[model samples]
Structure formats: structure tokens, C-alpha cells
Target: MASKKHNDHYTDYFGITDKKVPFEDLDVHNDTRLFLDPHLVRLRTSPRPYWDQAVKCLDTFLETLTVRVLSRNEDPGDLLKHIQEPPETHLGMARHGYRGHAASDVIAQRIWESLTTDLYSLFRVGLLEHIEDLPLFVRGIDRDITSDITTRVFFDSLAQFTMSCMRQIPELSSRGTIQIEKTVWDPSHKQWAQRTYTVPKNNDGSGIILIPRGWVRKRLLGSASRFLQTETLTYIQHSRAQYDHRGKLVTPSKKTLRKELAKEPHQANIFYTEAAKRNRQNLIAQFWQYVDERYTEKGPNLGDGLARP
Candidate 1:
């Protein structure tokens, strides 16, 4: 006799045969490349209290981190309290994503050092309003890394968010729950703490979550993609721009811009950051607006992604 075949998709397990589900109906068997974006969280409308709590958890820690990094003297231990390997929510693009992935120590230390050194210097000239923008200037950080950090810092809120989602759907809420432990921050006591939440779990025993479609993008709004599109690029263009005899702007080709960007004198974070500061107000507004208008899909179901012949 053959063993029973179960659906790996959350909706399928929950008996949903609909073409589309409101939340991200995740593939419970493996990790997806989608990221949990904070910008989208702020814009979310459903599950009001959960989104609010998620925002609070994220902001409280990030604000503290910014202040600590700016202080340049305090031990980063408290601020880094919740910085650790995130519990696999079966959401992210790790190489072996279902197993979960994150650089435990080096990333934490590097972010701390950058905040104190390079980022602090950049702040003096012009500050990025969203820490989500760090990947553009920070050497090795990317969306996946930030997503991991977000999951670690805001685990409880997300767990609760999942709770809210599960309760709203009958098939899931009726399925009962499993208890799981996650390391999180104790904002009141100013330390790290272990916390537990009852949530739906995978056969692999990892907890699963359904992110709101509104609170995610197929590709996150990353600084690497948008950095130059902002006024910063205008600044870079002007600085490297050639002038006609009459002082008319001479547009540089992409090739020219690349060559200039590669040159030693033009390679420092200072030049770009300084230019960014010149239009700081506009830069902040434009980036958020770009997030609002682009990428976030309205109506579609994510296919199983494992396409084959």
C-alpha cells in the first residue's frame, strides 16, 4: 500500500480549494522567496491591532538601535538583545530556505560596527529615514538578511498576527494548535527573553505564518534598486556631469556613470550620502511613495513555484 499524499500548501491543508486566498497562502513544506516588509505593515488595513503591535515592536527596537548607534559609547548588548537566528516561518529566500538561514554573529557585529562607524558618519550629513534602505550603502546586507532580522525582533507580534489569521479562518482555527518557543526582546525589562506562542505548525515542526497580501511585495523595495533613482542619483549625475561651453547640462551615459562610480575618489559613501542629504526631505517622501505605488500586487494567488516539465 502507498502512503497518503498531503498538500504542502497551507490553504490546501486547511481545505481551501479557492483560486485565491486573502493572506499569503504559503507553501508549508518549504520557504518562499517573499519577504515580510515593514513599509507594507504600516500600510496594512486588516487585523488592525496586530499590525499596530507589529509596528510597535519593530519601531521600539529600531529606534533604540538608532539611538544606541548614535551614542557611540554604550555597549550594544541590550539593543542587540533580540538579534539572533530567526525561527523559520517558512517565509524567506534562504539557500536551503525551509531549514532557515541567517548569519548569526558576523551580521550582528557588522551592522553594529557600521551603525557606529560608516552609517553614523552618513547620518551626520544625511540620514535615511527607513533602515530598510541600509542595503544600498552597507556592504553585505540585503533584503533576506533584513527580513531575518525583522522576524527575530518582531517574532511575538508575528506569532500573534498568525493567531489572528488562524482564528479568522475556520479550517485552521479548528485544527488546534502547537506550542513553540522563540527568543525575543523584553522591551520593558530591557533584555532578551524566551517566549512561547501557540500556532499552527508544519510536519517538520516549524511554525507557519500567513502574511497579508497587502503587507508584502514579490520583491521588496530595496535600497540597492532605488538608491540611484532618488535625488541621490540626481546629485551623483550633477557631480559627474559635464558642461557645455554655455553651462548647459551634458548628460553622461550609463557607461560613463559606471566608470565614474568605480573610480577611487568617487567611491566613498560620503559623496553619495552628502548628495542625498542635499535633498533629504524629498528622498524620504519619494521612496515611500514608490513603495506605495509599485510592486505590491492586488489580486493573484502564488503558484507552487516549483515549475517542472
Candidate 2:
């Protein structure tokens, strides 16, 4: 009976009585298909919410770093430092096994090439406003990389958040000594610093960083696929449509647009990139980001949906 037991969740393995815990019921053994979303992060306005301070740290640091890099005034060391593999939060899509946040010097190289070399006109026209937007308009950037950057920026706060949640669990509280040390952005100092945090132990004794149940979705807010299908296609539907002989404008349905865009991924990328560059004043990043946010506020969805509209 013991050998035949099937445990799919941490609670099942740990025998947690409270099934409706505040934090997500993560699988310590594998990566869950979820991402720590910044849109949701900003919605946390509960008095004394830990995320409020973290938002400043994250946005300011990412914008500053990107600006400095674009201006050719940034140090190579800082760029390399910013591109780091974040500790596993047990959230995100991972193949083979659950390696939460992953990136290396190669990603740093790609980012450098993207900013200075890639023909991403969106960056030059000022539409590439947020860090999350990189994956949308910039080639070689992916959700995994964005998720890594987000976790790194919110590292210390996540640790603190984990500690705060630990008190609500008896097993976690018993072992809550804040013993793990990791590098994180210190909002107080406006720089990265080392910090210790108490994390829930995995079955094999590894630490698991827990995110709030409402803080994640199946994909990041600026998901390329979702943005392409929704905002990008909507733009194409209007701009690409023509007037009939009766002088009435004809618009293609989403299904028709989707089928057209599905012909070639690169063709769709070029279409949206041009569309975004053309309507700089109208096609803002916040618009698309918010759409993903509102669709996922109900919490993480275990689906690979492109979040139409």
C-alpha cells in the first residue's frame, strides 16, 4: 500500500490538512505550468502588502538597466549580473523536468544582440517600454527568460513572502529559520544584495519558493502568442481590411485572422512588429499586458491557451 501510493501534490505528500491553503499547492517534484505575473503583482494593494515595494524594485531596475544598455552607457559587468538563473519557485513551463528559472551567459549574449543588433524597430520608436515586452517584439527572447528576470528582480521579496506564509503552516513554521542565502534586489539600497529566507523543504530536502495563488497564470502577461492573436491581429484586421464597392469597410473575424497568421510564425512576427512600430502612439504595451492580466485574475490555468481578446 505504501509503495503504491500516488502523490501528485506537495500537500498530498506532506499530508497537509488544510487543502485550501493561501499559497499554491505546488508539486515539489516538477515545475508547475505557471508564471509570476507583474500585472497581478501590482494589483496587490492590501495594506502592508510586501509586493508594493517589490514592484518599484522590479520596474525601476529593469527600465534603468535597459535604458543604460540602449544608451551604450552600461557596464558589461552589470549586464551579465542582471542576467542570472533564478532560484526555483516551482512555477513555470519546463521540459524534461521542473527547473524553475533557467538562463545563462548565452541569454545575456542574446539580450545584447537583441538590443544592439536585432532589427527590432519597436525598441527605437519607444514602444518597447517594459521588460516583459522583450519576448514579444525581440527575437530569441522567451517567456522562460522573462520569468527568470522577474524572479531575479523580485528575489528578496519572494523570500520574504515565503517567510510570511510559513507562519500560516505548522510544518513550515517549525523549520522557519531563514537559513537560505541568495542574491536579490534590495529596494532599500536600490541595489542587489544577499539575503537569507526560510523556504519550505522539498521531499528530498531542497527548498521551494512559494508564490501567492493569485500571483500566477499559465503564461506571462506579455505572452507573444497571446499578444499576436489579440492586439496584433486586431490591428491587422482594421489596417489590412479594405472597403467593398458599396464603400463599407470589411473586417475579418478572429478565426479568419488566426488562420492567416498561423501560416508562418515569422510572417506573423514581421506583421505585428511593423504594426506595432506604425502605431507607436496607440499600440501601447500596457493595453496588451492588461488583457492578459484580466483574463488570468481568477488564478493559474493549467492550459496552453493563447488567450484570445
- Candidate 2 has an lDDT of 0.63
Candidate 2: TM-score? 0.77
All candidates: TM-score: 0.79, 0.77
| Candidate 1: residue pairs that collide | none
User: Runs in model 1 with CA error above 4 Å?
Assistant: 1-7, 17-20, 95-97, 124-126, 173-176, 186-192, 240-242, 262-270, 276-286, 289-309
Predicted model with the maximum lDDT: 2
The CA lDDT at 209 in model 1 is 60
Which residue pairs in candidate 2 collide? Answer: none
lDDT of 2 by residue, 1-309 (tens): 012134367666556778887677876567767767665566554323666766877777766656656676434455447556554586666643465336777777667765654534554566665666566655556666766777788777777777777776766544333367788777666677777776776654567777766776666666556667766677777777989999999988878877877655444654566665666634445455556566556444424454555
